[model samples]
Target: MTSDTTRTEPVASPTDRLRRLVARTEVVLWDFDGPICRLFSGHPAPGVAGGLVDWLETRGLRGLLTEAERHTADPQVVLRAVDRAGLGRGVAAELEERLTQEELRATATAMPTAWADPLIRTWTALGVRLAVASNNSPRVIGAYLAGRGLADCFGPHIYGRDAALHRLKPDPYHLHRALNALTAAPAAALLIGDSPVDHEAARRAGVTFLGYARNARKARLLADAGARDVIGSLEPLLRVVRERGPGSAPRPQQHLPHH
Candidate 1:
């Protein structure tokens, strides 16, 4: 007679988990607004969203947005709401362009996330592919990256939102595009993002996600979304990458088991 038994594996600490994730990541898909820089840090997102709402009101299209959407701090929320309102392409295009202009202006005062620039450069030097998979317009991403002198780091692999408002995060469209452009398997790519939508997008794309939570609230939000790895700062990741050294060979690609 044989007795039934079950074995449990030891849980990996957060640092160990991050090291393992970084070791296997051949490509990194970065979200723009948070992971790279706070695009609206100087312009302020609430004001930008309000400006868009005010613009729509001037055009007598205020009814297109629900009360909550009109008060949203995220411009994307307003854009998505307008897209779902069955508005004509002309209206959508104008709205998108307005938002794009605001993003462009915001880039003038965009605040880089701590240690982000150095980490990006270090990772690129270490032979890792990089791409910007963001909801911001590619034009804005390009302008900002160019200003930072990091354009060559991503080259043409910067994927962003277009007129198709439905393809944003939680849709996994951009992540898939980045993977295809880099010719990297999903298991070999990792996305560093700051939102639940980013986590969902990575999940759909079969890519690993590392949440960048800049505050306690953001950390809690990512944790609540079932993210297995969350960091309050990019410095830890930067340090880990440095310690891994330039000659560190990438581990074989394998799908990270979902928690």
Candidate 2:
């Protein structure tokens, strides 16, 4: 399904350009972490990472990692390091389960993005197909979506982290899985994500990418990675969809709030 998705619109405003991109998209592949909610807002990620490291120490595997790997705040990095150390299936599975539990706990306080809830609903009503492709576990994504009353919008199209950490993005395995499930051509899909890894995965999968930069730093990161389009806020996209047509759109308001 890999194909070029270059836009042909001439001299359009940024918003108009975005509309054109959206207009061509048939499948919306969303990343679980950023576009939808801040999953680690309440349950800090660093704390969870530390907890994982502690779990390793208790098992007498503390010497397996260098001081830096042991102290790294990214659990994925730690998990991968463990695998490289030949810790085997048992350790990997145990780490994954522990991380899943932590993620489940985090879901209770996951903060939805500013316009994500309503915008997701609006897209659903517009007959646009939606799916989540994330590095997080599918179970956690399902739980969070169900809790927010957004499960029905995506149904069973949630592709998440596999037991093999090596297969995660920017490997494009999960993205390919999502596209395959939807029977979608990559050119006809748009992935809205917040990281360069997401952009790289989308590019490798030949899917159009819409970068969601919640702050200037993220915007710069995406740009540096050669992202053609990145937005600081989803407000403009929400406005376009909300003004698309009768009944399919939400009512226009005096101001579209920023997140």
Candidate 3:
């Protein structure tokens, strides 16, 4: 049975392995960026002038100028765009300060096409434990849950930066902490993420990884990261968890009647 749980790739033989593996995972740990709540915390959204401001080091118009040079290729036009955009109150400098590590993650965008309540509902009914384990700051993570009415699903038990400073994902520390808190064994916990970092963390922690490849590029990325099973959307994930609620011991084979 343990052998059957290792190969998670949806290939013919390994798919069987993945099935066993997923069946063994009873607890599910989810992330934000490409999985649940996508608020563009780390990088700026596309088409925004000086959008990648959070990554710049200089200050005031200096930072905006830097973002222009780094991203737009044409610094002159980039600066002009920034001026026209009027950036917001203290938006440019405060965004660049990188002061708290939390402020840098300052956006309010939800994962498009995601249905939090329905997904959480099914998992809850199945007795499966769920958690959010992203590196997103508490404020941003909270904002996401609040907007979606998902705060109740996680309560104060999620593992974002607000919960801990565990050097972020791909480290397994957050996952370890979550497992300890939930009182579930590592073998029984599953992690769903869009990045390879999440895959490495699961491998190190001996937890199952279900990669949600919301896009074509990410789908390939997750596959390359040793994802056991990859899906283009959350609905398939919901199906996996519901159809295969962690592997349980199969019923003992019946003995033939003595003839």
The whole-model lDDT of each prediction reads 0.91, 0.85, 0.59
lDDT, candidate 3, equals 0.59
Candidates sorted by TM-score, descending order?
1, 2, 3
Summarize candidate 1's per-residue lDDT along 208-256 as a digit string, tens digits: 9999999999999999999989899999999889888877847435443
Worst 10 residues of 2 by lDDT: 250-259
RMSD of each: 4.0, 9.2, 11.8
What is the C-alpha lDDT profile of model 3 across 102-196, one tens digit per residue? 32343443444475467776666666667777655555666666777777777676776432223456778777777777767666777888888
- TM-score result, candidate 2: 0.87
Q: Model 2: clashing residue pairs? A: none
TM-score per prediction, in order, is 0.92, 0.87, 0.64
Error of 3 at 238 (Å): 2.2
Best by lDDT: 1
Error of 3 at 231 (Å): 1.0
Error of 2 at 147 (Å): 0.7
